[model samples]
Target: MTKYFRSNVDAMASYIPGEQPQHGTQIVKLNSNENPYPPSPAALAVLKNIDGEWLRRYPEPFGGEFRQAASKVLGVPSDWIVVGNGSDELLGLIVRACVEPGKKVVYPMPTYVLYRTLAEMQAAEIVEIPYSEDYSLPLEELVAVDGSVTFIASPNSPSGHLVTTNELRKLASQLSGVLVIDEAYIDFTEENALVLVEEYENVIIIRTLSKGYSLAGLRLGFGVANPKLLQGLFKVKDSYNIDAIACAIGTAAITDQVYKNACVAKIKASRNQLATDLKQLGFHVWDSQTNFLLVHPPQKKAEYLYQKLKEGGILIRYFKQPGLDDKLRISVGTDEQNQTLVKALSSLL
Candidate 1:
């Protein structure tokens, strides 16, 4: 730790993101919950057509182009949207804007680990409410905390289970502070709590193009909230957080509804099939609305399977945390890649 660094910054642990292997095209990667499909054709077309002169000037400070596109598609006003470099950036912005030192930031544990890191960075009090034994939301416990900011991930990471809208509405109504719903994987599910924003002034729902839109490489995310709440977020955000090319491509991707829907449909189908296949192999697989399966392997330990699969040129996510040690989170890949994973597991087990 540096002598000049703030004590909070020196003491806090950084968030660890999913690994992006450097190996070229040989490994079947199911580690990150990235879309296995390509991005919309329209987005690619926009990227190819971007002029060099446009790159010379600074991009729009608020990502107007992408905001307009998102508004048109999501049925929200432009002023209600705030774009970010990624959802992670927006998450940090929320913590900075709402949570003060000695104030509380609450989130469910065994969810996104970043929530804890974000709270720690701000020197805020952390209230981590553990999920139920089956990995469902502990709604009553969360509401009682009444933090300065509360984060909830629907179709949560690693587990892939969803919390219902009524449940979230109940929690929101009871809380005194901001309720930020991180809907990064909501595209894969049937329910979205977007309407809650209209009903509750304290509610903010954030979405990312990284999952269903297959634009992880572009790093675009946006939040929809009451216009007044969005104005507060705008103050905390970087002056030019999103670049010109990202705005152009994000606009194109949002406008291409047909292509995006097709890709999501294929992924949903694959997710269902993958779960069924793993269950048939004697693994206890949870029902997932997201593009991943959390499975408990029948014979070998979860860590053993994780390492063995890595050696066999297939990669999946296995968290070393307490509750998650027994399960492996596998992103739903293309049929060929998934089949190869199953074959590898079958051979090893």
Candidate 2:
């Protein structure tokens, strides 16, 4: 088996996801930044009443209906978007299509570990630039690396800080290859780099229904870029990448902007409150634009709090890597759920 695998596949470290319990609803699930609210009623309606006969036919290639639904919302034409199983898949597609072995792949350090993993899969040269102490983009260093694909995760995970659009435009202009901005958590934030897509032909923005629309279980996401850039991805993607069920339900979800906005508003409110609660408990909380907060606990108790919270039936993210070993990333839950977490922390600390 060892001899059969590519050396890159054999040597690369696998991406470790947050813990997923057997009974998700049975516990306070906050380790993963999933939507706390139920899906849009319109989407649920489609889910419950999808025509069984449509399963017999292959799904419309490239999520035809969803592209149209998301078009009106994104203000992009259907052809400008390419649907995928999730933003993650589209990312892989980009790497596969662009990166030849030893070609460079660059991203900011401690932003998203998946960028490193994806680069390794391609056996590409990985260049990671460290963010400033305030988590500001190190634009000069990032642009210096001429990578085949450069990733920036806005409202970035683990830190929950957004790179400014002006900074992104600057980086995109200097980079020789595609600039992939992963905005999986953009719904919680007010400003985004969607405008950059229009200004830069090299830009591709990756978004998911998982966070904003309460569709984590559905695994549907899409990338918005110039049609010229997306044509290569379309050629490399699975013949029928999107399923008929997802097309129907995701269409319903994206169309109901009111419900999605309401859910995002609640999460943003909870995120603010949770940040305040952590600060009161002697944790240094960062100003966050995403639905999660990155906080440094008092007395270097990051691992202690992670274990104690789990023992109390609550889950939050703790990273053991350098620069993040002393911090924890908490996903915003329902008000009641967050109250339970804070009460537990108050008792433990």
For all candidates, what are the clash counts?
0, 0
- Give the lowest summed-lDDT range of ten residues in model 2: 21-30
lDDT string for model 2 (1-349, tens) is 3497799989988899999999645789899999999999999999889897989998899899999999999998899999999888999999999999999999988888888898999899999988877998988888778688999999798788988899999999998899999999999887899998888999999999999999998999999999999989988999998999988999999999999999999998888888888899999999999888899999999999999999879999999988999999998999999999999999998
C-alpha RMSD of candidate 2: 1.0
Model 1 deviation from native, Cα RMSD in Å: 1.2
Clash count (model 1, backbone only): 0
Against the correct fold, how does model 2 do in TM-score?
0.98
| lDDT digits (tens) for residues 237-320 of candidate 1 | 989999999999999998998998898899999888888888888999988889898899996589999999998889999988
lDDT values, one for every candidate: 0.91, 0.91
